[model samples]
Target chain A: MDSLDDYQIPYGLMAEFDTPADAMHAAEQVRDAGFTRWDVHTPYPVHGMDDAMGLGNSKVGWFTFCCGLCGFFGGMLMIWYMNAYDYGIPVGGKPNFSPFASFPVAYEMTILSGAFGSLFGMLFLNKLPRLHHPLLKNMRFADVTHDKFFVVIEADDPKYEEEETRALLKKAGSKHIELVNE
Target chain B: MANHSVPSSVKIAPPPEELERPALVENNRSLGWISDTVAGVIENKTPGWWKLTFGISLLVSLGLPIGLVYLISTGVGVWGLNHPVAWGWAIVNFVWWIGIGHAGTLISAILFLLRQKWRTSINRASEAMTIFAVMCAGIFPAVHVGRIWFDWWLFPLPNANSIWPQFRSPLLWDVFAVSTYFTVSVLFWYMGLIPDLATMRDRFRKVAGKVVKPAAKMRNKLAQFLYGLFSLGWTGSNRHWRNYEKAYLLLAGLSTPLVLSVHSIVSFDFAVSQLPGWHTTIFPPYFVAGAVFGGFAMVMTLMIPLVSLYKGLDEIVTIRHLEVMSKVILVTGSIVGYAYGMEFFIAYYGGNPYELYAFKNRAFGDMNWSYWWMIGCNVLAPQFFWFKWCRTTPWFIWVVCGFVNIGMWMERFVIVVTSLHNDFMPGNWGYYSPSWVDMITYFGTFGFFMTLFLLFCRFLPLIAISEVKGVTPQADPHHPLGGAKH
Candidate 1:
């Protein structure tokens, strides 16, 4: 399958830090050192890590904005085609292409597109709905929702080497490191 | 001494400690504040009007099961219906309720964005109002179809039946817009609530005393499950807060246009049709404006009575908060009034005999009295807001807010019944008054709305305790507002 999902990161490497700052620092070094297939797992979401991890500004909003524009035009087109061209019911001399009556439909479509655009775009972009993850296989992943921080280096990263990754993570201030495989 | 260490003007002692809680506890929901006033209000005795209101709503909502059974058994004919107005009360109330949801989002989101300090007191109740009202709003469209038993048909894709619901239908559009609004609003409301609920859970644990059956495992389990599901595992760490805050900001930004879109889509129900008064470009904005106007009024009406009964009014909800809401009421009320004039001007300018006559008949015909009453309540009553005396006085604001709700409801009444009463054909023209079912159902809806809200107030953390606590200088209040300095 030629898909982002097919670009699977099968094995995981874990690093633990007590303070968020140190964890975020390690995440940045891992990313800046040119490891693309990676993720930062924390007890909770960390600030500035997206920048640290070399993630671009999310294209989800662009998807929403574009889809919403599409919706606006689609609404106008549907209404125009259905009411004016197809049915042709003329009550007043108002244009068959009435922008006024079209506004409500356009408004709804904009909302519809923006909402679904963000949601579906997020799921698709993240390659979600896989039902399970390699992270879930790690019992230590449980504490990621609580009082700890960890960063995982995926085997799929081009720079990934078990001994090298461990050494790199230890130098970046990780208090503990573990190897995880699925 | 703790309060006095600060400069005199810098530290205002919030009203007496007893006046600071956000809403009245069940035992303390009565009126009065004598030396024994706390005793009086807190004696497991409720007030007359409130008891009456709560009782009526309880009965009506209890009948909701009955209404559902009737609807399921007898089909949608459980209410009056015919060809021209196949929708009737359900659709009317759907839009009304959804419109009702806006004020809370406005208070929580818009005020949050603008950095209004006063919103803390009222936003909790306002958000509760939003959730309950949206619950009420969501009901109508589900049952409006003849066989509501198969209501899942209001979906986006092709189903097992191999017939995808028409994307072209306005009702389908409403389904998508409204469901999305409700989903996001629920997400927004719940995500904001978890920390407060955790606070409650913690407080309740200590107050439960030693050896209390392992702390009601089932109850705790449900709260934990709900909390876990929604919060996505929040720990309130500064690092977590950074992302949580960003996610919230992103959501608020998303919800802003959503609020506008949902109501306008609802208005399309009428505007798309060519039924004289029904067909117009003005309906969308007018409906959205009127929704916000009524929504704010309802928000004030509930909050004033609530914060007065709760222990912490001055700090959590200051008089300044009331003043800010009064401004909102003023702004939205003006937009509604403007919409009214636009309708008239457009009608006159167009000079289509039927459209012009419909406007004339509403203003000067049999229903002229209701039209003027609406103008008086929604428009004229809010004008009193121009005076600070009126805005600051809780009793005064309550009275005016009451008028705004009545006026907005009447506006819908005038639109629906009057327009339908006299159509193009003089022979078919007739007045339609709601029968007992109509009036009862309307009352039931109020009952339904209040019942859910009262339960929320009593059970849930009606005030956003953590959010409010987050803003207090005690919680980083000394920081410049919205952390602009950061």
Candidate 2:
């Protein structure tokens, strides 16, 4: 098995850093190097790392906005359909359907659906709940949720060159760099 | 003489006024220290105090089920509901508990939006409090309807009766507001917990590997798997964090208006009616201010004790946090005081005899003692927070917060009972008081709330570990501790 190690599949090269600054600086170098298939990992979101990585704004707000609009209209329509159209009853001598009467419920529904949109939309975008990633298997990677930070360049990146990438990571101040197995 | 002898060249600029704020996490604690300290409370063996408290709470919590069963078996008549004062302790407790829930959102959502870094230490626990308080609040109206089974009628569900809930009604609006509030709070809270849960999962895995005993290993394995499952296999990838941060911001924004609306809708439950004391245009903002005030007081009441009980939590939840919270209490408490005065001013200036009489009755009538108690507790108790001694002393803050808690309940009592006990017609007026059942049921809710909170403290991260670390100077990329050039 030891002799057959060369045949094992490579997932990516992971470079570990003790501080967010080092990982962020490495991300800037990687971004400048024009690597598209890579990510930085840390226990918390480091401030200003998005620009360092050259990533654009997150698209989550659109999901919330669209769904919130739907919820508001849906709530209004539901009230109108149930009370005014389907089972009309005269109690307070007011109009059968007034937005004023329905605004509170509609507003609440807007928030409810908007929240759902934010959570599910975020999950959808992240491609999460994968449960079985090569990164999860790496003992060194576990610190990503503790105190350490990481930068991983996928083996599938077009500019991939094993030695060259390793040298770049080493140059960027990572003391520990290892190849992750798929 | 020494000053006169000093030369102009030797003159020193008075030390630049030290304006740098206190650190959110005291003692410049490291990231690993933050995680270990927070997760340690859950990972360590249960403390003796926790066992005793949980045992007592579990015993007391049984009163809720027993009281509910008896109430259901007998009838709503078992409560202190009378003809004129139909709404009683149930309504008062509902409003009070719901109001208590508001501080969590205010801290988590409102403070987050405002970029108040100190909130990171207290947000998770307070959010849990909000969820539990809302659960307690939900129970009252559900059972108060006299027909527990028919509570489903509040929703716009299809029914054989071919009747729909009145949309114009504030009661129906309450159904939407509270249920939405609960759902959004849980979502926002769980979303924030995911990364921390991942930390717990990884830590449990590390412990599981080191442990030798089968029982210990199995426990750790179970914890690891549970935390991992809920964590959604979080790897702290920047890609995920990007989306997660955006979602969090959006949720915070959405929740701000939702929190304000919830209490406003609750106030509408009374304000929409024609009752002299109840029908005030100032109800919405007044209720919101009161809710935030009571909620912050409850947060202090719970957190001050927890900070002392848990090891190393004092560094995370520092005196500065308590003092800042006390200032918030003072501000909101003053707003409530203003509302109180404004209500009376409106009552007099409006010149309606009934309104003026209602104000007079509340201040000097049979239930005036409750009014005075409300004033003393809600209005005056937090005034002590203006003093640095009172704000910084944990025991003093705790006592004042206890007063605020009781005062808030009194405020609700004065609002619900006083307003209802005196109708326009002399014949319709009557005195209202709680029965033993009402007292037990309300007491039982405290037990239920405490039981849930204790379980949370024992099993879950009591502080937001990741958020706290993010606020620490070490987490700042440009800070020297983060490897930046000095």
**Worst 10-residue lDDT window, candidate 1 chain A:** A123-132
Q: What does candidate 2's lDDT look like per residue over B1-486, in tens digits?
A: 223224757654433549656678888889999999999999888899999999999989988998899999899999989888899999999999999999999999999999999999999999999999999999999999887998888998888898999988999999999999999999999999999999998888766678999999889889988999999989998888999999999999999999999999999999999999999999999999999999999999899989999899999999999999999999999999999999999999999888888889999999999999999998988999879999999999999999999999999999999988886888889999889999899999999999999999999898999999999988988777887653
Q: What would the per-residue lDDT of candidate 2 be over residues A5-106, giving only the tens digit for each residue? A: 788899889999999889888998998899999999999999878887888889999999999999999999999998899998677688988999889999
Question: Where is the poorest 10-residue window by lDDT in model 2 chain B?
Answer: B1-10
lDDT of 1 by residue, B1-486 (tens): 122134656655445768654431222221111112222222233556657767877997765565666676776665766544455666667777788788888877777777765676577678888888888878767766768757886663446755444445567667767877777677677767655543443333333334356646555555545544443333333333444455456556777777877788788778877888889988888888888889999998888887786554444566777887898899989999998898898889997999999999999988898799999998899999999999899999999998888887778878876788778888776655444455565666777889888767655667665554444432221222212122
The collision pairs in model 1 are: B19-B311, B19-B312, B20-B311, B20-B312, B20-B313, B21-B311, B21-B312, B473-B477
lDDT per prediction? 0.67, 0.92
Angstrom error of the Cα, residue B200, model 2: value is 0.4
The reply for model 2, stretches above 4 Å from the true place, is A1-7, B1-17
Question: How high is the DockQ of candidate 1?
Answer: 0.06
DockQ of each: 0.06, 0.55
